[model samples]
Target chain A: MKIGIMSFAHLHAEAYIQNLRAIPDVELLGIADDDAARGEHFAQAFNARYFDSYAALLSAKPDAVLVCCENSKHRALVEMAADARVNVLCEKPLATTLTDARAIIEACERARVKLMTAFPMRFSTPLVEVKARLDANEFGRVYAFNATNQGEAPLQQRAWFVNKDLAGGGAVMDHTVHLADVLRWYLQSEVVEVYAQTNRILYAKEIQDTRVETGGLLMLTFANGVFATIDCSWSKPPYYPTWGGLTFEMIGERGVVLVDAFKQNLTLYRHDLKRAAWNSWASDANQAMVEDFVAAIRDDRPPRVTGYDGLRALEITLAAYESAERGEPVRL
Target chain B: MRVGIVGAGSMGVVHAASWQQTPATLAGFFAESSHDATRLAEKYNARVYKNYAALLNDVDVVDICAPTHLHHDFVLQAAAARKHIICEKPLARTMAQGRAMLDACRNANVKLLVAHVVRFFPQYALAKQNVANGSIGTPAVVRLARESARPKRPPNNWFFDFEKSGGMLLDLMIHDFDYARWLAGEVETVFAQSIATENPDAPLDFGLAILKHKNGALSHITGAWAFPPPNFRTAIEIAGDAGLIEWKSADTAPLEFFLHERAGDFPDVGLPSSPLREDPYTTQLQEFYDALLNDTPTRVTAEDGLAALQIALAAIESARLGKPISLAEARA
Candidate 1:
């Protein structure tokens, strides 16, 4: 697949470059971004041709385009990709507003092309396995859920990401969508209401230092009896213990399922550290996701991460943002 | 198989219930004191014994759910009786005690398995798998915790007594310390700060320890017994150059793993809660049974338990003296 790069404004844009390189079937045709310096940097780093503008990049007639630009630009980017009759793998928070998200979806519909969100975590192995297990009724009646997506400060690193107009909301908007989408996808349910709080504790720059709430907690009541408590905060130090953490816990009638994005070993100690080693064999899911995406595109099938899925996740993120801003539970 | 349960306290009951829930049969039980023993025995329709030696002689397998202070003597008694053993955590109060138990079990040719239930937790196991498979590059840092709401019942109230439970370090934080050692490798040194029980009348219930591993992996362990209510949690985080993995205990949610999707993309990964019916206790017990049946070494051996205990003891020493304690000094 000849993949052309959209604006390299979002941090996720770099990932598209890497993923495109990782997949043998995908070829990087050209790249463009409003930030001339960033576009040049990306083009030079990925060894791709630099297009002066989105129009020039579209003119190159790539098979697909990855929209790794800011949320505010997602709709326009998708529309451009659709006008050029190219598939899109848009970065999350598909749009700054629901209206923009809907418009992007409609444009993709009108274009008759695939519009998959770049929610790569869904393609992770542990999550896929967990989803299967939940479907198998391993935990029984999934009664409640709690999730956290946390990290250190992102204000100085990616200032634009904290802007409510550009990035939507802080952590609630930037981080919650991925988790919110998983809740919907795994439970086959939608969030009905959300009570959330957001804060800018760390950053004192032009953009909110912490877009997501630091120590911000949210209570999400799903369509089913699945009550979810979510914390989407960038509250740790830059060199936080976990690179970036997403924790999901599900409670059921029969048992409980707890998923940690990062867990290496589970051991016990009495008086020393030797002889107490509990090791299990499980495969990693990153390569699987990339491979699956390659296969899906090769077979002309819908991607594992659909645009509609992105829409749902985006809705929840917006809801959380609204709830935090209004100081009330925002109903979906 | 007909099983004998040692210890008749809260965990003893939990174990007995878990065994009953499984295909295993509970034939008898033994408690240090006859009262708790009789209570558990009557509830489970099993025999109760006051004498550890007599209890060892009656059962094919000895499930050592006794207090940490009693693990050494009970395990030695069980080993001499030629009973396969499954011992609860903090295998012994001291490394010497743990080593003696291991030596005795080895001489008797009886399989001795120290219960490291965290390994049995599916989420933790998955996290371990991720680390082994290089999910997060080489494990660099581990931040873990064993937190609870409040201690409804403690280890004979002696848990606060350092000679018995080794305070929060051994009774609780030892789990994560062992995990850090396992995933990140040897602990070269540890610096810890502890919250002494405010009410001198009360026991020490909270502690925090920072471990510096031989391989430069930094681990942080925090534990508290006075949380809220009915909240039992264990969380482990391992970060590597490539990605990160975290195992978080959940009352509700499935076990999940998160990986790096993009270099700097904020929405790196997401995980759906994976549910499971099997718990750490059952898995540990099964491991014990398998080791006994197959003439295999236990997954968590006595030596490993001792090492973890040493770390806990070191933490306590560090806290007490308000100085960083090297493993060498700890060993001494």
Candidate 2:
């Protein structure tokens, strides 16, 4: 299977490039970016071809492509890929607006190309195991979820995360999508209402220009009468060992399960780094998500994480922002 | 000073043990249900008071460990008797009850300390002190969680009643609510979601709350009565602009605080303890004694207890109404 990557804007692209190369039969054909220097730098560093433009990459006619541009810039690149009849796996928060999200989904459906959202948590090993138990009636009925998706401010890796026009919003847009997607998948329910609170006190001075929220707490009510909270904040400080992690407690009538999706690690107190560091030894969810994307294309089926899933999660995100602004619960 | 311990249940014994070590003498025990009242009174070399009024009259201070519905009467009577007070957490079952108790204490000119013992836990205590001392810079975001097995209550135990104990939100998570306010000023609003409390037959209860502090900080709190026996855990993570502090009650973490264990012999009675051999409960009550003796302020004031109750009650209301309750509206 051959695939190309569009843009090097999202830092996840670097890891995705590594994952593609790790697959036995997968070919990372090239990387394309409007930022020529960035495109060329990653292409050379990872030993792949460099395409100067999205049109050029699409014209190359790889079987599929991954979009890793800014959150708002996803639409144009994805549409162009679909127009070229290329299956696409778009980075999370699939688009900044509901209109854009809808348009992106419609573009893929119109062109008869597969569209998957890059939600790796759906493939998380620990989450998958508990989900299997949840399906087998081992827990009877799930009652509520207490979850968190926290990380350091991404200014060092990708500065665009703090830019409102490019990123859509702050922590709510950046971190809410992953767990929102996971909860909807595990519970197989639609969120009916959202109430959220956010604060900018943590990183206002660090980010300098944007007053976008650095800390956010979101409460979601599902159609199944299940409710959950998402601490979707980029509030990790500089000394944190790793980027951060995703964790949740799922409560059921019979039992409860607590999951830390990223807890498999070896901790070392290293003198060189002058801090305790965590070296992860866990299975990579990004790799699993990509493999699933590849299998869906081979089997000619929709991916496990579809564009509709992305749209639904984005709906919740938008509703959360409205809820926070209006100081009330916003119904979906 | 003489400290009369009320209610001879698990917490009653726990308090009796702690007060024995304090400078104050243990006055006696009083309980309608004498599961361990007689043994405990003997163990402390104290007599058993036949009634609440007799206990109040005999002791200079009253430490009430009764169920939620009994707290209002116990504290009011204790205050009326001109005794200093140390009441078990939740302070009262409802906002109005809490307010009335605070008012009574003020009118009687008596000192009342709510046993929010989490404040005295070394980890949390240090976290609050560090945040105040600029160790983590200005507090930006806080995550707190406390989950313990459903107490093996008698069939009619008020812990399971939403009106009497407020389920897990008022009885369990209120500890974190008070701690959150202590770490990051007063809260401005509360938004929450809960599960299973509405279903009387459900085996477990869970609650998640988001507190927006007046200082522009956000705190995400999770509390549950869902684990099986002997399975309980708590976690805390506070992120500020300069640094972050995180701890969890697990084998791998530095802290080994095993609170509220229904220990051997008294399979249904609690002996909340820390591996550090430090009893936060004792520390809490000792400070209460200091406040009464020195005529100074204690760590948890009656107003602080009232403020925490306001947040918990607001959380319960928000969970039921599916809306965010501003502190102004919650106050009203």
For each model in turn, which proportion of the native inter-chain contacts is also found? 0.00, 0.87
Q: What DockQ was computed for model 2?
A: 0.74
- Give one digit per residue, the lDDT tens place, for model 1 in B2-76: 678888766787788777765667888877668888887888888887676667667788887777898888888
Q: Name model 1 segments beyond 4 Å from true.
A: A204-215, A264-294, B1-332
Which DockQ values do the candidates obtain, in the order shown? 0.02, 0.74
lDDT of 1 by residue, A194-260 (tens): 7654444333333443443433456676787466656665544454433356777565544345687
Best candidate, TM-score: 2
TM-score for the first chain of model 1? 0.88
lDDT of 2 by residue, B34-89 (tens): 65788898788898988888888888989999988889999888888888888998
- Residue B303 CA displacement from its true place in model 2, Å: 1.0
Identify the runs in model 2 with alpha carbons over 4 angstroms from their true place: B197-202, B251-266, B269-272
